[model samples]
Target: MDIKQRNQNAIDLTFQNVTVTVQTKQGKKLLLQDVSGICKSSQITAILGSSGAGKTTLLNVLTNRIQNSKKVQVNGKIQANSTEINFRKFSEFGAYVMQDDVLLETMTVRECLQFAANLKVQGDQHEKDKVVQETLKILKLERCQNTLIGGQFVKKGISGGERKRTSIGFELVTNPSVIILDEPTSGLDSFTAYLLISELKRYAINKEKTVVFTIHSPSSDIWQLFDRVMLLIEGQFIYQGKGNQSILNYFSNQGFNCPRLQNPADYLMSIMHQNNKNAQNYPIYFQKYDSLLKPYVEKEIEQGEKFEILSYKFETSFVYQIQQIAKRSLNNVKRNPILFRARIIQAIIMGLIVGLIYFKSEGRSQVVFFKLIVQILIYLSKDGSNHPTSIRDMNDRNGLLFFVCINQLMMSLKPCSVSFPSMRKVFIREDNSKLYSPYAYFFGRLIIEIIPQIISPILYGLIQFYMVGLNDRTVGNVFFYFLCLILNSLLGLSLGYIGGSIFSDVKTAVFMSPLIFVPNALFGGFFKNRKNLASWIRWIEYLFPIKYSFNAIAANEYENTHFIPSPTELLNLEFSKWECVYILLGFIIGLLTISCFCLVCNRKRQQ
Candidate 1:
């Protein structure tokens, strides 16, 4: 079948004298040393090397993934289609498939491609569907179209090869001219690996796509598929030429002979330019390669690349992009059973626990003697919170009401923080691919995930509020309570996102989460009276959302109500009910803004 489609803007990529120096504890280290090569159009070029070969680094540099840090120095000139181009501008015309399969595990194979299609394929639904269907057929993913992408330790889904193919299918939907992949065949069986590479080869030739990828080890069949091969050792290229007999002759003359039965790929991998510290032989290898392999690429290298950057355009509207992202995110939530149902179950269990524990607000009958004993204890305690308690029983009931606020806020934090890190990479990868604006993803993700932010707390709060039998049992009061929970949940979700986006890994987030929340808990006004808190430390109470949530929930339930101990036995309620609500809502808005900034920072760090 003719799988090729028109509008594949062919580009010739050439990098000249590219060098990378990274700052390390030991000192400055050369990651890539004067690497230069040309990957031509409509050809399969394989970057072959063992570990520490600078294969992935070079690919990253081309795609603008390299960090522009003072500690990391990059010196090189890259040209696309013969015109000197910087990474950012060059990236628009290319599609990069990262080494890891970063697809959403819960999404089906077809759904995954369709989502990519929606973001990338600038067309109506019919055209987008056509692109997705054709991509599936071309990539040979039709068999696993309905299978899930699956994660490492979780739900089972498509095979490793299919996952890799789906990753490729994502790029194909956009119909990019230049396609680059890092270790496309890694972790696949020989047969599957061969099939995958063969399909890539088909794309390169038939579709007029510039294909380049790094591979650690290639089976003989896979090796034969490469139109050109660049062999790298340490950080320098040792060979650059056609992938045929010329390679055997070039290596054979360099004191390395391939045995008749030995695999050619293995033989090629064995020829290292330099192996040990004593015999630094890179200069020698460079000289030999110049005499032997340089001539082959000299003509290709001399051809100046002229880039028609205008050929690449974003066809989809921003609103359409947001819609696509929201749809896919919603679909992911639906597909993941843990996210869909288990969380609702968790909310119910949590609600039941809170309700059963604080089932009723009961008071003790003792008056004068008990009050005198409490006064003696308060006088004796050095850290006595100075606020006068409400009717002792009313104060106890208010404490329970405040617990509801604290519990809801705490519950909201883990969901966003725990899930954000896992999903951050996927978001970054998609954004990097230029699928949509970063702003689109920021809003789209918020829109889709906000449902749970609304649902979990309301469900938990509703059960707890009715069961515990607080002062405000009216529908209006319950509505305000529910609104408070929603705001608190959003606050927690935003805080979690902040932590997740700020930290690179889950462990750092997990370790640091407690240190932050512990303070918020301490100053949250449930444990210490806000008025009695040390003046300097009181600022922290304002900074944390729990204080506002507590104040709001407390004021709502306690204000204008008669109780056993008469509302302020000890705690002071200075802020009006509406004022507290406004403060908490303001905190939610502030948190969301900060979270968005952190997310943008995370995206920047990724670049």
Candidate 2:
């Protein structure tokens, strides 16, 4: 399509006097200095620069991805179709593909695009599916459509080129008015890079969309595909004009002719890189661009017409977002069955081990003690009965109860802490893309986590409860014991979520977890009596979920016992079993609320 025949969605992206500086100890280090350019519809613009030359910085600045802050300052006029706009307004018409391909590794190429469409495409199921298939075809991902986008730690699937194209397809499925990418061909082979840029060019022309990306050293074949080019040295633009020989001609005009058979792109890069010898040349080239080349861009910007700007909006409903996120999570769980199966198997094996080691020791001890009492009574009269011990010794019963509480808690905690932080990048990427809100993602993850939290506790309780021989085997007691374990597991998961959400690094989250959890475990009433703790510090027991859980299970085991010294009084638990249950529920809710707050705050900080 030609410029005039461009679709209504077509819009030119232009930025002038754009300067970005970061506050360092040295003060006001320039990242981009007065960069100016325009990316017109139906054309592809490539920003060329060496490492740390501010090509990506200029892209982020023009796209308004960089904001003024205590450490950073940005000054610029970014216009869409010549109308100045803010970031939020610009988001309505622009989509940015990050340099790193932050994709859900568990998903296949088709499924990934489908998931994006469900959250980003505005239509019914049929329309969303159609968009996904079209995107697959456009990005040439159909051959690997069903192959999982695996990672280094997981099973490897697609090649580097395919993965890169998949990342671009994520933004392309939306058919945005202006598509901007950072280092789109950074990790690809020469032929693959050529294919990627060629597809981008065809897509830009066919769809009448403005396309811009940053590249370091593109192959000569790849360089020929650019309709426009902007080269930067340090933070200033040295050239801003047409690509191909036009760039060579401009440099040759400045007394630097291309060597025969040598790549012109490489030739220009060598000139820019020769800092010690040509340190003075950067200013000259920039000055030439300002005096000779910039006025034409300025005239084009002045004469450009305005197009209608659309308001920023999400494509799907909040409920739909939660559904799609949950569905994808469930699918991931199905594909990666090792983790899920390991959790259940761990619970079963640990339950067997704990049960066998302490197998009915409490029951057997009470049975022996009572039989002696019966023999003594028989010397005076007569008595006998066949029954396993039912809560006579406070130490054995209380010990089992405490172990169960801590067991459930740790089992739930470690996995959530390690796994959640690992997915933080993917979550942040999707969140920033506006695919879904933090609340939706949090709830979706909660749904997946809750299933195991419930199932594992049930299996653990069923295996260990009767085998260890607690107070009474009544249905109420059994259900209450199971309930406490479940709540404790959920509590542990909540704390895990908090740690994972607060820290972006998995190792850091896991390392710091013990510092937070071990202190609270000391207040669980088994390690030290809550009443014996200092008056000032005794209140910590009330804040700890494990304390309430341990107390509740202990009270359940000791309630109808015929023990001499009351275990509940000895343990210094002021709350009843039901009261502790209620408190644990409150703790679970409160901890999860903190997790949500931390997650939301982290996202804001990233922005």
Candidate 3:
């Protein structure tokens, strides 16, 4: 294991004059200062330093994962196998594993790998199955093939090492020629960390793959496993070379003594921290590293004259991706009781509450708008003032009729917001791995998501439709109500999808979702008059699905009936019932389409 992994034809990754400057409120700051190095194939190059040493930043630059923003400046030339790196081509072959494990907890280990295989490997079911079996064996996860990944809520399954191995196996399924990881063993025990690194070393050697990772506080045994080591302090490389006694000697000669039996990893980290602390007075380590190691790096760059862009490779077709992802999404839903069943129960309870309030309210409509507005804004504000309603008119007919639509819309919004944010990390990990197109994942998820939206609303609608005594003409009304409910739910999901994809964390999505829905709910015709709204601001009515959905529900209940002398112009019930349905369908399709585009664009920029 002490010997450097090597294969003559393995890819050689070289970078020179790499500088990354990012903008901040105060000014532009250099995160990586002219860093340069070579990570030859069949070798494990570990970047080590104290926190904020720009170790991860360096990895991002080499892998072309750095965010290209107008506020950020990147200056560097990176060559792979003698040709300069081409982002489109490099993205096809290069695999990156983040510092945290991003996995679907509802799925079992084998199921997870199989789905990844189906997404990444272009072949029949047998071929995909073979890849899954081989990956399970290679990662030594055969025993836990059926064990769930588990989570904070579900029954626990597997261990820390197994989870990390699963993450690595995700990239390995694509058979990548180059693998980059950020702190792969951050939370594992020392022995487990040693084993994981050992397995990585084997991947590099046997598969002829280049391996690079950012690590913190690796054990002494783990330190010896890396083929090369790069040390950083304050965004500058302090050392980059073989991990051996020579490296220890390099620092020892610089007045930083390594105590007997001291772990080299810890010793290097301590010295780098000290150097960063006293850089103004003490001799800088980067100056010595540059002066001594310039020749080696320069020679490597000179020798890499055959670099060429690695063409983008997607094994599976877009249709295949959609099919496989759809199946996987359905499978995940089937396995998780909370994901699939809890929503129905929630919908039932909501139905009961609304039904009791509006029970047999077809003869009375004044309380309708007031109750619908109250339900919509309940999650937004603590006080009644947040939702101004008029219960003064007993003739405010069809107000309760419109509650069905507003109730479903608000209900659907939570599930959409809750579910998408939860799955965003998992989607990003698999999607970026080149497993499938963004459309495949998006549509597949939308399809599976519509299942709950369809079922939950049916239950709520049936219960409320009967309990509230809309039973006289319930047949036609129920069918249209159900369709509108599904569409409105999807609209909610799309809004949530946008917030979930745009924000990195679920907490942020949760905080922002309600605020976002405020405009939709207020302009939905239940809370205020749309026609009275200013001309410029009135356009927002077309943007939110709530407006169309409420209109459709009101039209279904009021048209040809003496429910009111004449429907309020603000209700805008000019259209027929079928027209309302078409409008709702339009909103559903449009919102999801926009959401998917924004997410795809966001992911592209992020990459």
By lDDT, the best candidate is 2
Model 1, position 584, has a per-residue lDDT of 75
Give a tens-digit lDDT track for model 1, residues 373-465.
Answer: 343344332121212235555566666767766666667676667666777788877878777887788778789888887888878876675
lDDT of 3 by residue, 1-607 (tens): 2223233336778899989999999999989988888887888999998889898888778777775678888898877776777555566767888788888887888888888777767678899899888888888899988989987765687788888888888878777778889999888999988988898899888888889999999999998898888888877777788886878988888888789889988877776665536566234676787788767777876775353544547667777778887888787788776756778987889888877876654343233323543433442212211111233332333566556666676677766776666877787776666677888788878888888888888777766654554422434554666676777666777777777667657788788888868877787877777767899898877776677777776665543443234454436555677886787777667777877886687674233
Which of candidates 2 and 3 is the stronger one according to lDDT? 2
lDDT of 1 at 17: 81
User: For all candidates, what are the clash counts?
Assistant: 16, 1, 8
Regions of candidate 2 where Cα sits further than 4 Å from its true position = 1-7, 362-392, 604-607
Please name the candidate that would achieve the greatest TM-score relative to the true structure.
Answer: 2
lDDT of 1 at 311: 55
lDDT of 1: 0.75
The C-alpha TM-scores of every prediction are: 0.88, 0.93, 0.84
What's model 3's TM-score? 0.84
